[model samples]
Target: MASNRPAPQGVYVPNDDDFGGYDDDSSWEEWNPTEESIRPVRGRHRVHKRGGGGLARSSTVLGVGVIAAVGAGGMATAQGGKPPVAIEMPDVSAVTDSLPEAKSLPGVGALISDGSDDSAAAGQNVAVAAAPLSAAGVSTTDAEQGTTDAGEALRARIMEQAENQQDQADDAVQKAAEEAAVKEAAAQAAAKQTAAEKKIAAEKAAAKKKAEAERLAKLAKSYTLPVASYTLTGTFGQPGSMWSSGYHTGLDFAAPTGTPIKAVHSGTIKEAGWAGAYGYRTVLELDDGTEVWFCHQSSMNVSAGQKVTTGETIGRVGATGNVTGAHLHMEVHPGGDATGVDPAAWLRGKGQSL
Candidate 1:
């Protein structure tokens, strides 16, 4: 006859002390054996009590254990008592859907579920999960690229500033050169103006000199000497015993008794007669009220009130009164006064020699 109770679903037994070291409080759940169950047919196995609450707790612990094993496999090393291992994760979206989404954890990325059927997207998620291992390398590459970009920008700014400064310097130099050129042009203009002024002054001086020379030439043509052929016997203001005055008052020309005397300038004869010691004196009155007296004359050729030109015969030389020898005495009276000036100097003033 068949037994009334159902047979055990699955079993696990340890050959050594590996499974016997669990604490008394530790609990396990029963698993049903199927074709996929990893159990040996001929080993000694043990059965544990099954409970609904314990089944949920055992499933959670088993999922955590599987994740930890996969993470450790990625970091495995072939050294000392361990061997190297490579971990390849399978798609687990179906399994993750049955559980609540895990909250964020420190030192681990968030557990986000992707329910899409695209194989390429699932592969990308796997690639992202592997990123934590290469985080250092990726960050180093980004930092170097940032540094290079910053250096290039700084160099460009410095070059722009240098070009601006060069432009300013060039402008200053050009302005200074323009100012210098203006100053030099002004100096040249001033020098030319000064030279023109000097030239004008020199021309005026030459003109004045030319006018003075012409005036002198015309005056010489209008005046003449008193007696042409005569010897200078006495000068005016000579002290002499023969003169009636204590000093000689006129110029004396010693000549032969009949020497001719001419009018000294163009004038009218004022008087022609004896005047005491001035003996047969003749007086000539000029247009400007000056008088010329010729004394000690042997004879008078011009009468009173006769107009005569310069160098015309007016009298003859003689020793008629108070004379040391035969000579003509001549006196010049400005404005026709009795007191006279030197006749020699008066004749010289008219461009004539004594």
Candidate 2:
């Protein structure tokens, strides 16, 4: 196709700057387009998803349209000298092909190389040019989104890392608290168990002591005092020299003469005869072979070999022989031994008190 713009019947010619900086006006005389001008791009450029997928046809159409528009603008500048309309190409979607070839108006072979002939290096160059912004370490997504803020991605990463660290620290503290709670519970359980065991032991000891006391109380029933209504004048082991022995070997119960004397415990009459200093002495032998002597008696109520019970009348208090006043003397001999022991203490052992 041919486009002719003849100057309006005037003898004026267009300037060189209006026709791709050509100094000779003859060079801009007439121009026509050829099929060779439409260069067939060998490789395809990948556009962003938001952009349409027709890279070859679109890019070809776009390049040809830009040259046509610039050519018209040059014509305007040469003819009327009006300020060339502002020719700014808005930002386009991302590309992944070699760089866009530098283009000028058609028929202006003086400016750019003839890329109508393609090669591997040129193709690589185009691919580099068409490569996404991400290939140059820029965020293609953000760039495509028209993001203007810098360091936003870096700030997001730092915040994410800090949050992770805080979460880990919280988990560690919670675990430690749980462990501490478990340990405290175990300690409390141990203390409770120890207290329960101690209480059980104390209860057992108390029961045992009560049982022993009950046993002792039962044993005191069988024993009685030798003579009631009599005053205790001399205890066993007294140091009075009024008797033949150096110390008093008997417990003296002072009483009026003829007062009744009772048997101390259930026993048989072993001896009911007199000793010279002992007055009318009576000896009783128990089933356990212990002997109790009752002396200074005015009269005996039972004969030898006779059985008697506790508290039964056996004799009368008297100072019949070698005595100054009426009284009764008592002695105890265990297992029929000739020597006697402290009757008061022995009675206490059997749960009896003086």
Candidate 3:
């Protein structure tokens, strides 16, 4: 008779020894399925009640073996022994990896679903170490900003000081220029004043010299003799002079018997008289109290208290006194004293040469 049955999906088949039912001598060796150990044959087979039961048991044992192998694979992955050692985690933007708002934490947390290797654990540890470094970088940047601000302030101060110094220098220069101009003006004025003074002094000296020369020429024109027609017979203080007083006291002039005698200067007639030694005599007094005496005259024409001008004829010359011949004696008395000076020297004082 023909038979029909379904084929198994895997090649594993269980034996009775799988249930621990065989004696020691009939014990089955353990089956480890490999690629070459089991294969399916193309044949129709009959199902027996006892054989179906063995097949069912075989399927159960195979199912149990597959379960144990998958459990061991899971355990090996957990213990950090898989080929994919580094497991990927979520970034900081993910909900599970977001940074906390707490001040105690400083960095983002990583979201790890399968952290099954040594490298994954090392990456998480690196994230923890970065927190303190980020905080230190913030402090360093703030210090650098402060230093930049200080440098700007220092530069501003230096510029202000330079401007002030320039202003002071300009002011000093202006003041010095003004002072120099004032000094120059003063010096020019002083020189002009000195020059004017010198000119005035020169003019005064020239005028004084001219006045003195004119004064000297006016004194030479004022003298006349006692008699117009006469000859000098005796001089003043002659060594061999003879007279009534043992010395000749006056000058003698020889002339004709009626020659008119005149006054030599302006004076007043004090006397007209006759004397013992001097025959018809006359005396004339001047303004400064000087007196002039004319003796041995032929006759007198002037009387007392009669004023006479210079060169006025007072009497005629004649031989009427104690004399050797016809002549006139002329005598000068300063302040009416008896003695007299040399008449030649006195005539020269009026710019006349004797």
Candidate 2: C-alpha RMSD to true structure equals 22.3
Clash list (residue pairs), candidate 3? none
lDDT of 2: 0.75
lDDT of 2 by residue, 274-318 (tens): 888888999999989999999989999999999999889999999
TM-score of 3: 0.38
Candidates 2 and 3, the one with greater TM-score: 2
Task: Give, for candidate 3, the lowest lDDT window spanning 10 residues.
Answer: 76-85
- Measured with C-alpha atoms, the lDDT of residue 69 in candidate 1 is 69
- Total clashes for model 1: 0
The regions of model 2 sitting more than 4 angstroms off are 1-213, 243-245, 321-324
Worst 10 residues of 1 by lDDT: 19-28
Give all candidates' CA lDDT scores.
Answer: 0.76, 0.75, 0.69
Q: What is the Cα-based lDDT of residue 220 in candidate 2? A: 60
Error (Å) of candidate 1 at residue 173 is 22
Q: What are the TM-scores, per candidate, against the unseen true structure?
A: 0.42, 0.43, 0.38
Over 89-121, each residue of candidate 1 has an lDDT whose tens digit, in order, gives 677997778765353544333234357798786
Error of 1 at 252 (Å): 1.4
Candidate 1 — which residues are off by over 4 angstroms?
A: 1-212
Badly placed stretches (over 4 Å) of model 3 are 1-222
